[model samples]
Target: MQRYFVAPEQFRGVIITITGEDAHHAARVMRMKPDDQIIVCDGVSRSVRAVVLEASPQEIRAEAEEELLQDSEPAWSITIAQGLPKADKMELVIQKGTEIGASSFVPFESERVIVQYDGKKEAKRIERWSKIAKEAAEQAHRHRIPSIQPVQSWRQMLTLIGEFDLALFCYEREGAAAHGKGIANAVRQWKLEREKSSDEVVQNPRIVLLVGPEGGFSEREAVEAEAAGAILVGLGKRILRTETAGLVGLTCLLYESGAMEGA
Candidate 1:
């Protein structure tokens, strides 16, 4: 069945009214008609299996048959703070990151970043990224779409680091153990500690993964990041590309947190 995300207002007492882009896709693109079955999600944690009652260019209304059980969302709300890379690399990251179970994304500027922020194009850029996230979520059968935050400056991004339960700063260079450890080992230890501290699962725990641009973070930036309560970490033996490192780290984080396996 085709899946569409609806607003809280769109679904009322088992009536799911999909409007705007979803309606256009259902009506014109998919050629959906009355009696067609579909699944509608509220983009948080709730989803309903419904049968289409009416389809038009502006609206497609459906009647809920039963509430669908959804647990696809991860226990941790992971956000990827990517240092703005060149070209469409950020698009690839956001699309794949959403599929990999990221809760949101933050594109920020770093000392080594090449792409300068375009204030005039920022709105359109973010709009495009948001669309990518939504389409990816639907294709991935995700209950919620990942949020794309406004691009932040280096200092501004640093100020937001302490907000997360754990922040892993991705550094390509292999440094002393004091600097960092293998991502798998680090995240596993963190998870173990969390479980030991509280027997109950900590759902919705906030985690932020930071990956620098082409040349990676400078020594000064590294020291500042650690000072801001972020753990400097390496992906593995080989140095991954700017866009790939964060995805790999995110997968490691989610898997270690028991999200990849199941609820």
Candidate 2:
């Protein structure tokens, strides 16, 4: 079934309204018509099965038939804090990362970063990324769309380290014995802790995995990140590009959390 995302307010009781580009796609691109079945989500978990009542380029209205309880989102809230890569590589990361179950993305500036965000077009860039995430989420049958955070400076990103329950940093020079625990061990430990915790756990534990730019993080930067509560993890013997490292780290977290398993 086709899926669409709308604001929370767009849903009024049994009536659901889809506007803007989504409407255009459904009405024109897909040639959907009345009585067609589709799914609509609030982009924050809530979703419903609906039968089209009206379809047009301006707007598409549907009546909710049943509420869907989809368990498509990952158990862990994984955020990829990536260093700005060159060209459109960031877009590729966001698109594929969402399909792979990343909950969010944050672009940060690092010493080895080759590309920097332009202030003038920052809003446009963010919009593009958010759209990519939304489309990816829909295509992947995800219950919620991944969020895209604005580009953060080295200092700013470091200050936000305490925000997540855990932060994993992928360092090219990182080692298991020297850097505390390897990623697999660290994630398993964290999962065990979560399972032992009481029901008072209000939300999925948030994890921010940081990956450096093309050349990776400098020794000083890695040291400072470790000091700021970020667990440094090595991605193995071979080197990966800035765009691939975060995705690999996210995959590790997802697999460790049993997110790759069937529900």
Candidate 3:
């Protein structure tokens, strides 16, 4: 069945009014007609199975049939703090990261970052990235769309480190060796500790995974990250590219956290 996200206000009572691009996609592109079964999410956790009541150029209305649970979301709210890479690599990151279950993305300027985003270009870049995230979420059948934060400086990224329960600094060279703890081990420890807590406690823990740019983080930045309480860890033996590290690490993190096994 086809799925699209709509605003909570649109889902008034038993009716779901899909407007804007989604409506256009259904009515014009897909050529959906009345009685066509589809799913609509409220951009939150709530989703309902609905049958199309009307399809037009302006809007598509559907009659709600049943409320369904959003079972695809991971237990851990994973956020990727990606270093600004060159070209269209960031788009690939946002697209695959959304599919891999990242809740949000934060693109920051790193010490080794060569690309710069400023003025109107920055705004347009973020807007494009946001759209990619939304499309990826919809294609993946995600209940909630992942957010793309505006680009920030390296120091600015540090200030947000304390917001997460765990902040993984993706350093392939010296991080794991210096910390003496691999990514898998850290995840294992987190899980074991969480299991010891009460059921109602620590319901949804937040995690931040930070990956550097093409040139990667400098030694000074690595030291600063360590001081900021960011856990330094390596993905594996072979070094992964900036674009690949976040997704690979996220996959391992989700699998280890029991998210890939399903709730």
Q: List the residue pairs that clash in candidate 2.
A: none
What are the models' TM-scores?
Answer: 0.93, 0.93, 0.94
Cα displacement (angstroms), candidate 2, residue 36, comes to 0.7
Residue 234, model 1: Cα distance from true site in angstroms:
0.3
Evaluate model 2: give its TM-score.
0.93
Per-residue CA lDDT of model 2 for 94-150, tens digit only, reads 999999999999998989888756889999999999999999999999989999999
lDDT of 3 at 44: 82
Instruction: Report the lDDT tens digits of candidate 1 across residue range 1-263.
Output: 89898778887898889989889999999999999999899997689889999999899989999888888888789999999999999999999999999999999998999987798999999999999999999999999999999999999999999999889888766433445587777677777888888567666789999999988899899999989998888887677889998899899888887887833
Deviation of model 1 at 110, angstroms? 0.7
The global C-alpha lDDT for each of the candidates, from Candidate 1 onward, is 0.89, 0.89, 0.88
> Model 1: runs farther than 4 Å from truth?
175-180, 195-201
Q: Which lDDT value does model 3 have at 177?
A: 65
List candidate 2 stretches off by more than 4 Å: 175-181, 191-203
List RMSD in Å for every model shown: 2.2, 2.2, 2.1
